[model samples]
Target: MKKLLQIIIGLGFILTPFYTNAHVKWFTEVAPKKESIENILSPLFMGLALLAAVVLASLTIIIPKMAQMPLIKKWDDYLSGFRKYSRYLLKYGTAVALIIQVTNGTLFAPEFQLDSTLLTVLAWVTIGLLLVPHHIATKLGASILLILFIMVTVKHGIFYMLDYGFYVAIIGVLLVGSTKLENVGFPFLYLGTGLSLCWVAVEKWVYPTMSLDIVANHQVPTFGFEPAAFIVMAAFVEFVVGYLLVVGILNRVLGFVVTTIFILTTMLFGFTEIIGHFMIHIVLIIFIIEGVSFYNPPIKMHKTRVDQFIFIFLNFIFVLSTFVLIYYRFA
Candidate 1:
């Protein structure tokens, strides 16, 4: 019962008020209805499902037990050592994110492309200030970020931009939070990134044909499942991992898993995956190093194996429920 309550500790629905008939109509108009669920879930999908089950079990069971082994303890200690450089790592990472936004011609989204040279120049200027050491620069950076946020929110609409706008908001949090709270920034970044991933995951569910098409063209291995089922399972994994990231539960282990997945994807897809996910690679490296920041620790972390298992399982359910509610309401 205590653990169930703990699941909701930091879980808050950030309602996007931009839910209107127009947006609903837009999504429904474009959503693909050709795929069948049973057709997608084949022998391969079951195999992948079994692997996912093992991973879930390992997180709650084997991982906690492995932590007691000497080899794993040394690894934990080594990772803990990187916490000292977390701030510097995050600051520079912000710069790379901004550069990627410009280079990609999109703020990480194809729809929200910044077309104007003037706005691009301004964004780069603010990005430059972020790298500078002057204390006043932080406030100036925050001002520019606020201006950009308003521009995006006004031009793109909150609902439209909410999918990837969180990245921009993360930059704002760092600049504003540095000058004031000195702490609010990273937590917001962590949350924003998680939400961004989950939001993108929903796209697969909404437009399964697009992903299935990609799968067909690429001949991507489905671990024995049909293309549609693999795509759906991929969405679930992305959403669940994103949820785990926000709640700060077994995040380091998940970080490794996601990183490995991305690397393997690069091997399979070749250069396109590399170019598309470059900034994400940077973010994953940061999470891999930092684990979860201690800045937003409301849930009392448990040490015992049983307590850890309950905590992880509940967080998974929390994210799963959130995803279902959001999908039904928005998608």
Candidate 2:
């Protein structure tokens, strides 16, 4: 047990820097460039990808066993105690994200700048509604957020706006609050946020040039790997994180590690990093609080150990390939 803990912690420390710097698009201006499918399917890429799949599959078996351990069970239960407050965290964290966006003259993301007075005022109004204590007020705020999202989609095109799809999930959570279906809100949040991260990770593979540019310009450390290879590893790390979130595996531990990584990156990326990732930070906190106690993840359906391992391994490969192909096709 002690050795296993040390290994996990060591891997986390090594991967932390890569995860922190993976949001290249947010920090750089390079346009997406299409790489040849052959280049993307290179031996090194496939090898690392297969290795990642095996590791994830192994974890699907290991994590459940780990959860039964006394210390881990206690920690999970302690975190679960805070689940009741998730709604408030989502509500005010969203309000804070809106305030940051409106004050900066942007919409949901830093790249989508507000271009008109009416839109700016509506953004503020949405923030005001979100701040109100009533459920109706929060729902109205979510409605306005949906409108703002649509407006930005109309201006920027759906492909560009898809990176911020988690906003729609946030809107869903707000609208469904205090209802019989409120239970579904957190699951949807996890799914939406997970898919968004996976989508962004695909961008790194599709447009390696952009990430390469960010690393070169920002002098991001590569830890002895060449910049291009480092980008590939980073993208894989991010994709695996998203996959874990979607599968509801290691919710609290994953949340704490990822949130810490994002916070550490602020030192390098500074204010822009915070503005771009504030909502994600909030979502991770909710993940820590919720900890998959109230929900049955897809992994729970497998019943047998071998079936569970196969399910995780195949699904990781399938999701990674599907995301890469779809993103590359659309790009």
Candidate 3:
């Protein structure tokens, strides 16, 4: 009973709305009168819901165990069944940490005024978590993460969906790779992830500053500056980083720098461009994990048909979008 309650509490932490209250606050502050109530009460309701769940879970653990019921004994058995696999835990945990660090630092850190140095520290922290063995606590971590990610992506739309897709793919790869499938079709996975980043980079070139100032202004800013310079720089960064990422070169360094830039943009201007920074932060984390230096994955399987299909799809979207952004910016 106690174990089950603990798991329930852990899950609550993941799904609770208060976790993203900052975003809600920003939205409510900017929303018109009609939507103000949603902005105000949504997070509050969520917080209360989670609090209730936590309290209930605590009672389940404390009351039943003290009473020594058969139900509690049965619950403990079920809890014991969900044991953590240490090696798998380390590999996967490190992978997640890397992704989160990059997302927060590079893609979204700037919005928060965080330093790039903090990214490095976070990277290490994530890596350290992997070194430790998985406990029921780790399982709890994974479960909450999975649930929160699912909910956030669903609420956010295609951009969020794609973000979740990539994350899921990475998690699947890590979980599968930790087993005998270590030498399996890994390059394709990295390639897919890299292509996505590269595409975004290409768009950046045409909108150096990502027209971030306009985002800060909460409306598109007047485009009086020479957009050409920014566009060129963005393109160069995107192409170089994209190509290198796929080829497996200087991943950690690149990830650090990329995430740093993202953080800068968001902290500096993301409030006005809420969705932009939100999506960017999510991608930055994925990129960082893909770029981490600690683990050396041996190549076994080449790109399969499904992998090729995704590659083509992403390539088309990125290339088409890049040209469109460029044309629009110049026009």
TM-score for each candidate, following the candidate numbering: 0.72, 0.92, 0.37
Model 1 stretches with alpha carbons more than 4 Å out: 1-62, 165-169, 176-180, 267-276, 293-315
Top candidate when judged by TM-score against the true structure:
2
lDDT of 2: 0.81
Model 1: which ten-residue window has the lowest total lDDT?
14-23
TM match of model 1 to true structure: 0.72
lDDT of 1 by residue, 63-97 (tens): 44666889766776777776555555555555655
Write model 2 residue lDDT over 227-288, tens digit each, in one string. Answer: 98998998888888888888877567767787676557666666666667778877776787
C-alpha RMSD for every candidate: 10.3, 5.9, 21.6
**How many Å off is the CA of 206 in candidate 2?**
0.8
lDDT of 1: 0.58
Native-vs-model 3 lDDT?
A: 0.40
Q: Rank the candidates by TM-score, best first.
A: 2, 1, 3
